[model samples]
Target chain A: MIELFSDLFSDYTLRTVAMGAALLGITAGSLGGFALLRRQSLLGDAISHAALPGIALAFLITGSKAPLVLMTGAALAGWLGAALISSVTNRTRIKYDSALGIMLSVFFGFGLVLLTYIQRNPDANQAGLESFLFGQAAALVERDVFVILGIGALVIFLMGLFWKEFKVLSFDPDFFQTLGFPVRALDHLLTGLFVIAIVIGLQTVGVVLMSAMIIAPGAAARQWTDRLGRMIMLSGCIGAVSGVGGALISSSIPGLPTGPTIVLIVSSIVVFSLLFAPNRGIVFRKYREWKSGKQLRVEAVLVDMYTLAAQHLSAEYPHSARVLDVMSSMSGPARRTLGLLKDLGLATQLDAKMWSLTPEGVRRAELIIQRQFGGEE
Target chain B: MEYAIDIRDLTVAYREKPVLWDIDLQVPPGVLLAIVGPNGAGKTTLIKSTLGLVKPAAGSVLIHGKPYADQRVNVAYVPQRGSVDWDFPTNVLDVVTMGLYGKLGWFKQPAKKEKVAALKALAQVGMEDFADRQISQLSGGQQQRVFLARALVQDARVYFMDEPFQGVDATTERAIVDLLRDLRKRGKTVCVVHHDLQTVPEYFDEVMLLNVRRIASGPVGEQFTEENLRATYGGRVAFVSALVSGKK
Candidate 1:
């Protein structure tokens, strides 16, 4: 582990790749937080897949694999895809989900055709163009790192400047409209930013798995918080950590891919949060239900004892275990409840067969009966 | 007298199907008007059109003798409770502070003064204790109260509330009625899309009976009658005669 840490700092190539991946994670995670909350997670998937054709066209036009030129082309293509989806859904009877699916398949299939055409050519640079399919972090150099840093900083800064507008947009666009905010412009601006975020990740996680990078951090962060501000910040941190961690692990080990490794790390965090987070987690909710079920059983046993005492018009009226079982109608063991009641000084066991309420137990049972039935009995 | 709200020949259509047709209305200030009708009566569509949320194919709406766009700052709207996802990651105070966003404008954050104002609005709705609580943690009644607090902070001269009393507890229902009356006492025009026909005369000073077109709209005592209700609701209102007779 110590050798791995030292190598992360000492190896120049590894340091550059890790830095670039970290920047991709931060921007994608923050913007993905908004997409997740807006219930547009599938849109992220569609947008990422839509960037592929633009990347191939950029390579065809420039005949160079430069990150800046390719990324600009990718961003434009992604924006076009997004615009087409919206227009199709808004202009026709097609639903948003169907439009997204249509755009995803059409754009990605065209991108593959372009990629195949490029591969058939006699160009040497076309060899690594397919790396953008699943993202080769090791292919990123210092220049790519600088590009990621600049774009990531700009995206984060823009997010902060429009934070209030975006929050209202996600929460209630109708109310925002009533308030005279430019709802359409803001909506388009957010979609444009989402396209840029996806464009940046095309070379890190690639189009195929980039949506996972966008979604997992936000999904994990949501389980831990109920505030948008906190969720965004935490998601960014989760993304950055997983990005650098996956880069380091994949570089140290030979065969593991960096993008999938980061996605796996983030997925594990999401699963852990789903099971362990306090109020919203499944485990905590089940535990609470189990505890309440036990309390209900105890209350049922006390109420049954009170009913038995009432029937005889005596405080110390004793009933057999068999009689108490029939009266409670509980599925669990009656003896277990009796043991619990005895521990609480609510019931006394006389000799072998009879069970009766103590003075304290009678008072307790009366209080439970009154609270449950409003003292009607 | 200057009308607070004036709608002239307002007609709205959705996908070539008309929802509201050839409607004209003039509402005076300092009155609580309830727009009551059965389901699919375009009650909500009327409010949405007046606020410019739903586009009217041919019509004009004016507030204080000015177009709605020019008078946007003086208007506030409370949408249906089901319109928003309650699980959104925001606290009650943050939701309430959003009411002031119109005045705050773009790229500006709410300051300490705005927060204090939001808290005061929450207090008005008896939700001050829940200022820090997540919106999803609130009960249905508390959610309604929180939404009211949000609109209260807007401090608009005209208020449009859609189904504020729907799905709320009795206490919240009474609280919202008192709040509406309080708004009227302060000389603000308040319009509500209401569902409960039995409480129309008791809660509102004026009533508009509508089903696609306005059947009748005037002072509650003069316009809210069995005949008008029957016209608005058509054959679906056989039980309204009994209710009106009981009131008599």
Candidate 2:
């Protein structure tokens, strides 16, 4: 284990893999941020599945998995699928989701049939092709890593340059169209970049799980922040961590699929963020609400005591030693209420265990009730 | 006088159902015209055809005596408030800046001047304070203001707005009307698709009443009378009168 750690630090191949994974994560995550916000989160799924026929066709035509041919096939198929969905939705009455659903199933089904035929055919010498389904990172060559990094850098640069246009089209497409901007073309460009990211992820993360890499990190980051720049950056960071962490862990464990492992890691990050984020997370928000309710009840009790005692126009109540009198002034869950106030230092135990409101506690309670329910009669 | 928008027998159809038929209208420069109709009266389809968003089946849309393709930059549009996804992750400033993109053309980012114009438009709509705020954080009125700001940055000679006051509050409606009047003063032709029947005279100088067909269109004095209103919306009353007069 120690030797493997040392080797990971020193080996150039391993270093290349880490850098490649990080770049891919950043690219896919950034584009995924917009995709998730556009409520087209399932676009990643459709594109990844659509890329399969492209890969298969490219190899069948060229008889080799040449980088250029593979990318061309992937980009062509991806663009075609995206354009088809859009045109179908606009021209026909068929809904967008239904169109996307049909495209995904048909394209993926065709790709599966083609791939099976290729695997059984005697003329096809494609080795390690099945790995695209469930990625085998051990088979990723140095050239593959370089391709991922190049596509990643290009996507990031394009995103920066057309940031304003993309923002306009996604938010107010009608306004964008009104300004004579080609909103349709901009949409195609965004979807194209997303397809490229999915293609790069396919080599190692595989089609089955690459979709999660494209969506989960962005979805998780969305839970934490609303700002676009921050959300994209945070999503990139989360994707990078999941990618690199999954790669490292899978490399350590024998016979484990890297694609599923990475998806698991990405989903775990999403789960962690959804539950524990400060403002929007489920658990923390519930906790804050619960704590506030408890505090409000205590304040309500003190206010009741304060108002009751104020009738006497004195600092202390003569019959303050009676627990039943304090309890009688309040409503709803009295047993739970008295115990909470006593526990909160708002009241003190007197002789025979009777309770009296503390001065600090009395001041806090008086302010709350006065502001909330001030002499409404 | 340059006619900003000139339509010659404009006919548009959707799936063999004619939405607009043999419509002829000419909008002169520096005029603020409002198109009023009931629900599904093809008001949107008219503006869309003029903007080249929808293809006309048989007529021509000429901008400055030319096709819209030649004068695309001279025309700007503001669609209905609910037509867009508000939850998108873009700020108001970014949206407004896109108005300059038509002038800048492709592959070029908006310059500092464009940004300044966008900011100026935002100020005009009292939305300068929220220039950097995400569009989702805005109210319906604020959202309409941002879109108006975007169209203002377009700096077009002709403006087409489709139901711009649909979901806006009274204050926003007034602000938008004032903005349109200001645009008219600046010699820009503004065409608005309006729905309110009560505020037609106060808000618009000219009115075009439609009911999937041209009912009456001219100055308010000549075209917007009870006769015109009955033609546009009083089908049953017209039928009863025809029967009583022994004409039907």
Clash pairs, model 1 backbone: none
Model 2 regions lying over 4 Å from their true place: A1-6, A122-124, A283-377, B104-112, B234-248
lDDT of 2 at B247: 19
Query: What TM-score does candidate 2 get on C-alpha atoms?
Result: 0.83
Q: What value does the TM-score of chain B take for model 2?
A: 0.92
Best by TM-score: 1
Candidate 2 clash figure, as a count: 0
Interface RMSD for each candidate model? Answer: 0.6, 2.4
Residue pairs whose backbone atoms clash in candidate 2: none
**lDDT top scorer:** 1
Give the DockQ-based CAPRI class for model 2: acceptable
lDDT of 2 by residue, B1-248 (tens): 66888888888999899999888888888888889877777999999888777888988889888888788888888888788877665688977887787777766877888889999999999999998897878999999998899889888899999888888898999899899889989999889999776667777777898888888887765676766777777663444334223311
